[model samples]
Target chain A: MHVLVLGSGQLARMMSLAGAPLNITMSAYDVTTDRVVHPLTQAVIDQTLDQAIAAADVITAEFEHIPHDILAICDKSGKFLPSTDAIKAGGDRRLEKALLDNSGVKNATYYVINNRADFDAAIQHVGIPMVLKSALGGYDGKGQWRLKDSTQVDTIWQEMQECLNGSAQQAIVAEQFVAFDREVSLVGARSASGEVAVYPLAENIHVNGVLSLSTAIDAPELQEQAKQMFTAVANSLDYVGVLAIEFFDVNGELLVNEIAPRVHNSGHWTQQGAEVCQFENHVRAVCGLPLGSTKLVRETAMINILGEDTLPTELLAMEGCHIHWYGKGKRPGRKMGHINVTADYSGELQRKLCEIAGYLDAKAFPAVHEVAQKIRS
Target chain B: MHVLVLGSGQLARMMSLAGAPLNITMSAYDVTTDRVVHPLTQAVIDQTLDQAIAAADVITAEFEHIPHDILAICDKSGKFLPSTDAIKAGGDRRLEKALLDNSGVKNATYYVINNRADFDAAIQHVGIPMVLKSALGGYDGKGQWRLKDSTQVDTIWQEMQECLNGSAQQAIVAEQFVAFDREVSLVGARSASGEVAVYPLAENIHVNGVLSLSTAIDAPELQEQAKQMFTAVANSLDYVGVLAIEFFDVNGELLVNEIAPRVHNSGHWTQQGAEVCQFENHVRAVCGLPLGSTKLVRETAMINILGEDTLPTELLAMEGCHIHWYGKGKRPGRKMGHINVTADYSGELQRKLCEIAGYLDAKAFPAVHEVAQKIRS
Candidate 1:
């Protein structure tokens, strides 16, 4: 079967790699150039976008923010997995919040702020110590503001106003900041047949709102809650592919932080730790194939290598280290690659994580250091 | 660093896939067309052969039978791993035998038959119930004659004469047939820095001389013997890439059958079973990168899908089944692809093997049936 992916990034490249062995040909639509290239396909690249789309049995996106026009075209084909509504819900904070509320899933208390009156109402309802975020086009800590006190509220409001002007639909959501003990995420796949397979909850560490490290947590209660949240959201959205729900573990209570309606970076460790990686499971779900086993074969820790192109040779030489260098040009703050380290036990995994953290720049990889500190304590 | 592979087949494709995450670019030289294409590279296919060769930091072959002229050119560059001499030894039966003998490796008792006198001498020494094989251009049960009785010697001699006419050296090897309990092979990699890592020996089964199934065997004594044989041969050849040595396990004694100087089919299970696959290790060795761990992460069984294109979806739906479909046209007796099934324990692996064997045609996959029977008994 032929699958057309919307983005031509490393995720798409990996999806193609996983699909090739299953006899599933993948072609990526480069949104910038309007050109299509089969990342790991055996067929030579000669087909146009329209030709590829016409030939594809299924269409999916590598990232959540697919252009509306392109998504509309795929939607009309009736072969798009996860549906356009699901992508829209993931793209817009307001829509995602509404879906979570409708599904009876517990999320951080929030209020929508579109204008001065709405902002005043949000401040009155949500109170201080809240995060103000644009409803659309916000990721990796961008388009966000933290309100520490009334003194800082004006400056945060002025900065958020710029986001309102730039956004097509000028709106933002203010969420009450929860003093969470740890951050966690659950990544799972739901098939068209309503079959769901959820991976264990991953304890995540984010530096500057960008995920730095994620290790599969063995907390049974948290895992059960994550599964429930995933099911509620997936069923509500009629999801038919991999979905990730980031949660804040507040004194053992799981509060939804965000949802990614695609394969997530937090689940990268699955490539080495689980029987089937998230990328392959996502492909299988979208292609209408049976979902693979999500059984964890080993304890794994993933460290994201952001912006750095040159890596130390010793990093590759490290035992249990699996480097995944995205073949993209190096740019500051860009996700160039990641390292996955697997071990037989959690202690060994933690030690390996500390060793790898020592190899990376402390400023660039603050999350790794945080995780290492937590493990040491 | 860039690696130029002198064959654009599935082996090269898999090698490219494994090399991508290591930040290594691989360009494949299609000897048939004299064109080069980087299999997993982000770079587009637009460079000429000379340009690719000039740009490559190292050169290697996916298969042993590399053309003499191309091998010579690569040899002149002094960047080719596993020198042309090793490839020559692997290509010709006589040269391989001499190397094995000189290295003091125990191989099948054989006599070189070049002329009528040698053929007569062979019949006297090797006796009846022997196998006569051409020294060149033989693979997958081709260019072979079985002398089950003395009465069939004259007809076999005339048929063998045609192979002599086609061969450059005009030679054949006649070996005394031994009843073997089972077939096994050892696949290992040796780096330029004299670092060697060997995977556990795999018990193999061939149907019509085409490999059908291979499972990683845990017999310590046989595994030790296989590793010693591999080290002896690799050190003698000064090899610097993945090498495979096929062995015949009679009772408990191991007899060398043949050696392949590249990644062999028997090692395909490593993709899912080992910490690092053979292809990845080969790329590491060739690129001067540190070799990865060869630790067996799980028990695995690899079944070759020969001459079939239409596979049942149920085979994929089966738990632990990993399909590797080579994008090649199917022809009778041709290796179309392979299926690798991994399990946590040997009993689970045996059950999975039986389940998969039931799905395959009994006649076309007799080896699978045989294994299933053995496991059942």
Candidate 2:
């Protein structure tokens, strides 16, 4: 079976790696170029858009920002998985909140807004210490504004108005603040046969609102809860591929932060930690194949190598940590690669994490500080 | 750092996958086309053999049967790993036994034979219950003869002579049979830095003299001793990549059977069971990168898919079993693919194994067998 992905990036490259061994061809729809290339360059898929869509047995997106025209072509071909409606819901916070509410899923309290008056009214009702998020095109903390106090509300509103860029009104949503202790994600897949397999919950950490690291652990209770959540959401939407739900741990209560309607960044640890990677499972579900095992092998931590200013070559020589650099040019705050560190013992995970963080930024640790202090001493 | 592999097959394909994420370029020398293609079609390598050898940071092989000329070129470049001597020792059984004797390694008592008379003499010396094997180009029970009794020796010798087919004198070896309970393999890697890590010993089972399944387990004391023996061999030879040492478990003693200079089929389970697969770890060691974690997540069983005709699609539907097809044109006895089944519980592994074996041949297992039939009214 052949699978077509909407974005031509490293995620697509990895999906190709996972699919090629199954004899399933993975071709990408380069949204930017409007041309198709085998995700890993095994085959050139540069046919007309319609022809390419027709050639595939199933179509999915690597990211939510896929061009609407391409999605329309896929919709006409009837090859899109997770459905366009699901993607739209995932893309727009208002739509997602409404879907969650209707499905009886738990999420942060929020309300939709259209204009300044609406925003003011939301603050009156939801109060300060709330988050304002654009209905679409928001990720990595962009397009989201945190209102601290009434004294700063006017300046924040003015800045938000500047962000709208001359549009008299733009769609946005307000969410009540939740003081969560930790963040985690559940990556799961559902086959057309309705067989759903959920990978272990992955604890995630972010730096500057961008994912910095993720670790997969065996938490029986978390796994049970995550599996039920995934099943509920997948069954409700008739989802037929992989999806990831981000959850905030608020004093042991799980609050749904958002859902990614495709393979997610937090799941990258599965490439080395699980029996079957999320990429392969996604392809399996979409291609009408059997869902694979999602069992974790050991404690695994994946560190995103963001804004690559060249990683220390010395760190690449460290045992137990495998470097994975996306074949992408470096850009600040952009994901260029990641390092996966696996260990048999849980304590080793933290050691590896510290070692990796130290390698990335020497000054971030006391050993590095001591070295600097020694130079000064 | 860049690494070049000498074969463009599944081993090379896997090596490429492992290398790509590190941004380390790996090109495979395609003997059929006399051109180098990126192991995964990710890069175009040098077309000329000389240029490939020159451009390569280190040279290694996916199989021991690499062309001697190319091996010599790489040897001349002073960049070849595992060494041509080691590969030659692995490729031919006579040389292999000789090396074992010289290294003082424990192995089956054997003697080389050049004629029917020599074969008879060796059988007499080694005893009646002996096995005769061709010195070269033999694997999975091919080019082998069994001598059961003295009366049948002449006929067996004559038949073996006929099988040899008039080549002046065909080289062969005869060995006294040793009672073995099971087979085990030690897969380990030695880095350029002289650091070595051996994966947990894998217990293996063979059907029709071909490896049918393997599982990683904690080795007994005797097995640990055998692993130390392998470590000595690896260090003595200055081997810098993954090596497989097959052993025969006789009574409670472990004796060496054979050695593979490159990654062996038995190690395929590591693709899903370990933090870093054998192929990638081999590439990393050869490229002077640090070794990856070799911790096994759970017990894993790998079943080789032999011959296209026996390819079982039903096995793909089984839970926790991931099927990998090599995309090679299937032929009788050809290794087209494999399935890796893993689980936190050993029962899951056995269940998947039975399901897979059942898919291959239903008649092999009795659907319903009554041990006793009572003559009841």
Candidate 3:
């Protein structure tokens, strides 16, 4: 089967790798270059988006931040999976929040702001200590603000107004902040036949607003809560593919923080630790194949290799530690690659994480250092 | 790092898949067409073999049946790994026999045949009820004959003479046949720095001399004996990549049968059963990277998908079952792909294998059906 992914990035490359074993060949439409290319080789194909869409047996996206015109064209081909509406909801915060509300999934309370009057009303409606996110384009802590007090509102709004001015479709979403105990995510796949399989919940750690570590946890209660929300959201969207829903675990109750309508970073551990990896599952789901078993095969943790391109040579020799590089040129804080650490049991996984921490730079791998310290303590 | 592989078949394709995760990119030299191509896609590259060899940081072979001229050119590039001599030894049965004798490994007693006189001499030397195999270019039960009695000698010799006429270097090798208890293989890697790591022994089953099934076993005595022979063979070759040694287990004693100079079919179970599969280990060893741990993570069995394309869809939902397709056009008894069955324990793996048999056609998957019946009866 031939699959054409909409984004030529690490996710698409990984999907290509995962799909090949199942006899699923993949090509990607580079959103940046506007060219069709082999995701693994990054070799540009002499084919247009129209040609690729026509050629593909199935069409999907590695990300949600694609241009709408292209999405519309792909959607019109009747080959796109998980629906373009799901992609739009993931990209636009207002739509996501509304979808969550309609689906009856617990999410942060928010009000969309297009002008100063709406911002003032949003402050009144959502209250202080609010998290402000740009509706259309903000990601990775960019185009965001924290309105901690009334004194800072004017100053924050000035930046927010600038962000709002970039595109007419853009707006600020002022959300009522919910202090959370920890962050976790549920990555699951829903087949075209409406069958769903959710992997074990992964506890995620963020460093400076970017994801740094994700460890698959055996929290039965949290997993139940997350899966319920996941199923509700997926069924609501009529989704068909891998979907990742980030949760803010406040006390014991889980609240949806965000949704990624594609294969996600938190689920990368599946490559080494799960029955069927998320990348392969995503391909299987989108291609109208039966969803594979999402059972946890091992106790595993994934450490995001942010910014750094190389790891300690000794780490390669370490049992259960597998490195996956993105084959991209390096830049500061980029998602260069990730190391998946697996163990027969949970305690062994923690020990391996600590050992991994020893070989990693504390500055470069702050999340792992924090996790190792926490484990030690 | 870039690797240029000889033979753009499934082995090279799998190597490309395994290498991509570690940021190792690959292009393959298709010996048949004399074209450089991507191993996975088989897309003809615009570059010549000379250019690919020049561009590669390391050059390796997926199969040993490469043309001598191509091998010479690759060897001259100063990048080819495991040495062309090891490849030659793997291709030629006479050199392989000599190599085993030099390596001090226990192997079958054999004599080489050139003409009718040599055949008569081999009959006198090795006696009747012997196995005759071509010296070069024979695999998968091809170019072979059996001398069950004195009466069948003339007919078998006629076919042998025809085989010898194909090439000047070609001859027949007559071996005293051993009635083995079982056939097993050991796949291991020797690094550029001489670091050796081997997985547990896998007991293999062959149908019509083509491998049909391989299961990772837990016999400690056999593992120890196999490892000793494996280390001896690898050390004698001074090998710098993954090498597979086939053995005839004669009442718990292993006699070297044949050696594959690259990753072997018997090791495909390692993809899901062991840490760092043979394909990746071969890549790491040839690229001069650290060898990954060869620890067994799961009890696994591999069922070869001979001459088939699609499998039962219900198998996809089976936990511990993973299908890997080679993306090849099918022919009668062709090695089209394989299925990997994994479980937490041997009992579970056996049960899963039996379950897989129920879903597979008996004639199409005869070995699996045989094993399943044996387990049940």
Candidate 4:
């Protein structure tokens, strides 16, 4: 089966790797280049979007931030999986908030702000200590502000207005920021036949708004809550393929922060920790193949290799530590690659994490260093 | 890092897949077409052999049957790994026998035959119950004869004479065939610093001289013996990549049957069962990187998917069962793909093997069926 992913990036490249063994060929549509290419090789194929869609047995997106016109074309092909609405909602916080409300999932109360008056109204509705996020095209802390007090509203609004004015469809989403104990994510796949399989909840740590560390955790209470919310969101959308929902763990109760309508970085640990990796599961779901088991087989953590193209060669000598480079040229703070560290038993993963930290730059990999320090203490 | 593989078959394809994660890009030299190609896509790359060799950081072969002229060219480049002599010995039975003897490893007593006179002399020297195999290009039970008794000598010699007269390089190596209880193979890697890392011995089962099944076994005595032979052979060749030595297990004593200069079929179980897979380890050795651990992480068995392209969808739903297709067209008796079945603990793998046998054809997967039957009864 040939699957045409609607974005040419690391996610598509990983999907290609996972799909190859199952005889599922993966190609990516470079939205910028307007060309179809082999994701892994990045070699351009002489085919238009329509031609690619026609050739594909299934179509899916690697990221939710795809152009609506392109998404519509793929959706019209009747080969796209996980529904076009899910993709749009994932990209737009306004739609995402409505989706959470409609699905009856626990999430932060929010109001959309389009202008100065709307911003004033949002402050009244959502109150102080709110988080302002651009409703469209905002990710990894970009186009965001934290309103801790009334004093910072003017400065925050000036930035928010610039983002809103830049894109006519953009608006500000003011959410009531909950003081959460920790952040966690649930990555699960829903099959065409409504079979849902969720991996263990990954306790996440973000450094400067980008995910830095994600470890598969065994908190039964958090997992049960996350799985329920995952099922609700997935069922409401009638989702096909993998979906990741980031949640704020507020004193053990989960609140949906956002959703990704594709395989996620937090689930990368599944490549070594679980029965089947999320990339393969996503392809299996979209292609109408049965979902492989998502059972966790090992204690594992994944550390994002941001910006740096090179890592300590000693990392290769460490057993159960697998480095995966994305084959992308290095740029400051770019998602260059990741390392998945697996352990045989409980607590061993923590020790491995500490050992891994000794080799990484503390500033570049703050989350790993923090975990190491915390564990050592 | 860029790697140029010698052959554009499934082995090269898998090696490319394995190498990609390490930011190692792989291109293949298609010996038959004399063109460079992407091993996975089989897309022709517009580069001459000399250009590819110059561009490559490392050059290796997926198989040992490469033409000597190409080997000479690559060897001259000072980047081709594991030495050229190891590959030549693997391809020629006469050289392979000498290698085993020179390495001081136990093997079958053999005599080389060039004509009818030599065949008569070989019979007198080696005695009855012998196996006759072509010195060059013999594999998968082809170009072979069994001289079990004096009654079959005349017909066997007639067939041998035609093969000898066909090419000046052709010769039959007559060996004293000792009845062995089972077959096992040791796949290991020798790095540039002469660091050797060997995986657990894989108990292999062959159907019609074609490998059908391999399972990682925990026979300490056999493992120690196999490792000794593996180290001897690899050290003798100064090998710098994965080398597989096949053995005849006669009451736990191992006799080196043959050696493959590249990764072997028996090591396929490592993909799902071991800490670091053989393909990745082979690439690491050739690229001058530290070798990863060769620890068995799961109880697993690999079943060759010979001559079949499609499998039942329910097989995908089976826990711990992973299917790997070579993305090749179906051909009669071709090694199209394989299924790696992993289990959490001891005895679970045998039960899963039986379950897998239920979904496979008895004739197509006779080795799996035999193991299942043996385990059950």
Predictions in order: lDDT: 0.87, 0.77, 0.93, 0.94
DockQ of each: 0.69, 0.43, 0.90, 0.95
Please name the candidate that would achieve the greatest lDDT relative to the true structure. Answer: 4
Which residue pairs clash in candidate 4?
Answer: none
Q: Please, what are the lDDT tens digits per residue for candidate 1 over residues B1-377?
A: 78999888889888987887887878888888778876543234677777878989999988877678888888888888888989988878889899999889998888999887999999898888998888877878888899999899889989988888886675899988878998999999999888899998998888888899999989999989888999999999999999999999999999899999998899999999989999999999988888888989899999998888867778877878889987777898788889999998999999998888888898777888998988889
Of the two candidates 1 and 3, the one with more favorable lDDT, higher being better, is 3
Runs off by more than 4 Å, candidate 1: A40-48, B38-48
TM-score of 2: 0.87
Window of ten residues with lowest summed lDDT in model 4 chain B: B344-353
iRMSD of prediction 1: 1.5
Model 2, position A351: C-alpha lDDT score:
67
Interface RMSD of each: 1.5, 2.5, 0.8, 0.5
Provide TM-scores for the models: 0.97, 0.87, 0.99, 0.99
- Candidate 2 ranges beyond 4 A from true positions: A41-48, A109-117, A166-170, A217-232, A293-297, A309-322, A343-348, A351-377, B38-46, B114-129, B149-170, B308-319, B345-377
lDDT of 4 at B115: 84
Q: Chain A TM-score for each candidate, in the given order? A: 0.96, 0.92, 0.99, 0.99
Q: Could you tell me which 10 consecutive residues in candidate 4 chain A have the lowest summed lDDT? A: A345-354
Candidate 3 global lDDT: 0.93
Q: Relative to the unseen true structure, what is the C-alpha lDDT of residue B127 in candidate 4, on a scale of 0 to 100?
A: 91
| Model 2 CA lDDT for position A324 | 76
